[model samples]
Target chain A: MSLAPSERPGTHPDDSNLSATYALVLVVEVIVILGLYWIGRQFG
Target chain B: MQWIDWAIVAVYLFWIVWTGLRMGRKTEELESYFLANRSLPWWAVGLSVMATQLSAITLVGTTGQGYNAGLSFIQFYFGLPLAMIILSLTVVPLFRRANIYTAYEYLERRFDSKTRLFTSLLFLLSRAMATGVVIAAPSVILSVIFGWNLTLTILAFGIPTIFYTMKGGVQAVTWADVKQMVVIVGGLSAAAVALIMGLPDDVTVGAALRTAGAVGKMQALDFTFDTSTTYTFWSGLIGGLFLSMSYFGCDQSQVQRYLTAKSVDEARGSLLMSAFWKIPLQVLVLMVGVLMFVFFLFNQGPILFKNTYLPAVQSSTRAAEYAGLDREYAQAFENRKLAARAMAAAQADGAPAGAASFARSEFVRNDTAVREVRAKATALVKDVTGDPDYNDTNYVFPTFVTEHLPVGLVGLIIAAIFAAAMSTIAAELSSLATSSVIDIYRRHLKPEADDAHYVTVSKWATLFWGLFACFVATFAAEMGSLIEAVNVLGSYFYGSILGVFILALGVKRANGDGAFVGLIAGMSAVWWVDQHTATVYLWLNVVGAVVVTVVGTIVSLLTGGATAGPDAGKSAATRAA
Candidate 1:
């Protein structure tokens, strides 16, 4: 029997939501990188 | 060291052994032994995940990095949280649903058997050698500090780990890892606090930061677009993203961590927990090193931290030359310290221009002296050891630990180091055994074997890999940084493995032969890139995964001749074959 999408243990339900989360995470990561760069330029 | 320090270490070791022995009863079955019956709490799994990642090399080498280089190293982990979050939504759930013993097993189901076997073998080869190096890292430091034999130090820490892991399997490994993580964080946090408190009364934490900032030690990021550089923002984001994805997604060592979680949500939650904490935690760890750099500025710091090379230089005929240089270095440091204090006082007195000018000259003089001492030390070491590979950047924290921390705390910290080493060693060995027996032996050689028989063989496999790691640990001293060596080795293969998984998941048309060929091509491409390009090793993941997926898909289209229907039975038979 094919496993239902929701019944499947590890897979999240919505791809769009997952993509949005990923984009959000990428944004945060960029900010962190930029922040570190600013700090390095100022202090280093 | 005091008796209290020994007592703390003794108690910690005793508890570890007890925990391992206690968990032994639950390890009789293969599933329970390998995956803790998939019943672990998120907290335990989370802590275990963090513990496995933070080895003794991190505790010592990273602190040493901070002591010398400042906080730039923290940028290396910026991609980790993003990687973790991405994996949670994709591979974490998929692997849990597949219900496989190893991550490699999923490659067979999704792509082909050869892909699975190739990836599993890569993991074994990398992790086995890496385990030896990991064990040897702390042992080298201990031997240097205590004047003990290296082989004895390896055995002292490695043997107990083997006993528990071979006895209790993943149950012992996960529980021990939880405790080890606690001790490691406690030891590091304690060290940071002590270093801060121990600074000169005249220097506030703010002033120390200002000094470190002034000296360019507080540089935490590099936004330059240089593929050749190891820790730039782009390299960290793109290269680090792929590396983290491949590591957390496909590598069995980490895959096995989440597999033990009670449910998919728990596993994803546990991984997310690591995602959330990884960057900040690394920042804290590296900050300890930066603070130590500040500490050394106010206090009298050693000209050369690794004392092992000092004796060799003294014994050489050029000893007089080295001694003269050392005398000059000491006098230079004295003058620089006086100048630094005067500059600080001048700044306090609102003489900005005078303070700036004095600080500028003092900085140059101090930096010149530091470079001269380093060059002298390196040359002397080369002369004495006859091995040009001796670098003392990795030796900084061990020197600090042995020389600075109080007696009782010293033993606790030492035990924490042992805890970190043993946790990683135990996990790698256990996962190695699981992959070997379940993915290879049980699938091909003994398909009809009973649980009891498989369990017996698994224990034996664990013992075998453990013994092999200890044997390898004897030679690990030749490697410079155990942490860097492990990742470099992983870079050679992790990208290719991640590629196979991507093909299996995203490309439905990709057949077994295509995957098998693509896997080889992927590894070859990565090796070529590594040999030819100036790109950082972390970027190998992106190169390998993308190459394998794109190549594997094209090869599958050419070979399979436009077959569009899902070939589930064909895929299964290919795996069975």
Candidate 2:
């Protein structure tokens, strides 16, 4: 089977796309933590 | 408690059974029975994964946790999204590409049949016992709350699950899960709405949340670096990550869910769905509990939520002491109600920061006073009943449901709890059937059999396991400490299993001898660390995984490391044989 450029091992989008997905998930997590922090400070 | 409520629950059971039976027609072959012919859509498979992981205990217990601990428990899931992402990249593709029936089936190819046999045995033993506890928990809680017989309650939870899973196979389990997910989520949403409506009209939603925040219920993030604490941000993120990895990647119950997906990308999508939604879903569960806490602030609630021994406590010699403590709890609860009102009002009125903070501190003190009285009452109950390790957290949500929810809705939520139990039970029963037949029965007793013959035997295997799990549930409930024993056994095995998988996929040099020995070393280390140190269950997964990898690497190198990949897997297995 012929492989797509991005689908090949050690290639761009697979690596880069996975990295982006990781960044996005982690970033959202940090935002959630910060949101909780703000609620505690504002309301607690 | 009403006739209408009973009808609603009966209808739910009948509906689920009907749906499951309808799906059973597709399971004519072994592949279809276990893996749904590998044609399932990602979304349905994703819901099945979520529903199967959630159990009746978590449904009831988490709300209780929210009522008691607030949002700090959410940190326990901090590593989940990352775990899902990692598994998508690694195991989702690996397991799918290997095209195996059981996760341990790969172990045989990667190492040796003995390794596959050993790992599969570990999965079977731990999972079988754990499934029993899963059935017992809700039944015990329901029996206590509603005056139902425990034996019948166990059957009520178990039999229908067996019927559908035995007849319908994995297709039935997955489709039923899709519907159960709807019921489960709907019930939680209904409870949240009712709790909000239950709050005194004088208290706004904002005020209620702020008051709960004052007592630390709204503090979802605990960024403490303390390794000693259970639900801190670090523990949840790091320890939770390892646990999630092990659970989703290594356990067949979960692996079977994704393995049915139509493509590798579909498999990855299913896991990523969990990655994106698990914490938020947990937040919804925890928020219901927090809302319950808020609802109780203005309302009177039981001092001790679980009242199984309420009669005994009343009739025993300690009755006077229990009554006295009850009175103390009432007074403290009353004071806290007033204090919570003031705190909520102050925040709503935009009181000066100093004044608001003062009101909050008073509220906290009053809450502490109520909890102290509860501890005394709980102690008195333990003395009277001769059952130790008793706590009331599991009872809180069920109690709230029966007392506060409208009659029809109470039945719906009860059915929802049943849905949760059935979803988990169904998945595990099918998985146990799959592993027992494919890994042990077929692989050993009869390596060659028609699909029809195997499917017939697989059905019998499913029935046998269902009955066996029900027996275990009944036995565990009678032997109260056995529940904890099963839990500890699972905690010991989960990480070690994951460690073997990591050694297979990530370490090319690791062979059968190394993987097998590494698994033993990993479990032994976890046991030793658990006994010798104060390391919590979460960190133990990390320890097990790390020790197995390091030990396996050394053992493999000493044994002359791998010749290469899957071929190495086969060669290593042959050499080990």
All predictions: root-mean-square deviation over Cα? 3.4, 3.6
| Stretches of candidate 1 exceeding 4 Å from the true structure | A1-44, B346-357, B478-487, B561-577
User: How accurately is candidate 1 docked according to DockQ?
Assistant: 0.32
lDDT of 1 at B317: 90
- Per residue, candidate 2 scores C-alpha lDDT tens digits across B350-394 of 577687778888998998898888888887888889878888899
- For residue B377, model 1's alpha carbon misses the true position, in angstroms, by 1.8
Candidate 2 segments whose C-alpha is farther than 4 A from its true place: A1-23, B350-354, B563-577
Question: TM-score per candidate, in order?
Answer: 0.92, 0.94
Under the 3 Å rule for N, CA and C atoms, how many clashes does model 1 have? 2
lDDT for each candidate structure: 0.78, 0.87
Clashing pairs in 2: none
- By summed lDDT, which 10 consecutive residues of candidate 1 chain B come out lowest? B561-570
Highest lDDT: give the candidate number: 2
Looking at model 1, residue B166 earns an lDDT score of: 86
Worst 10 residues of 2 chain A by lDDT: A1-10
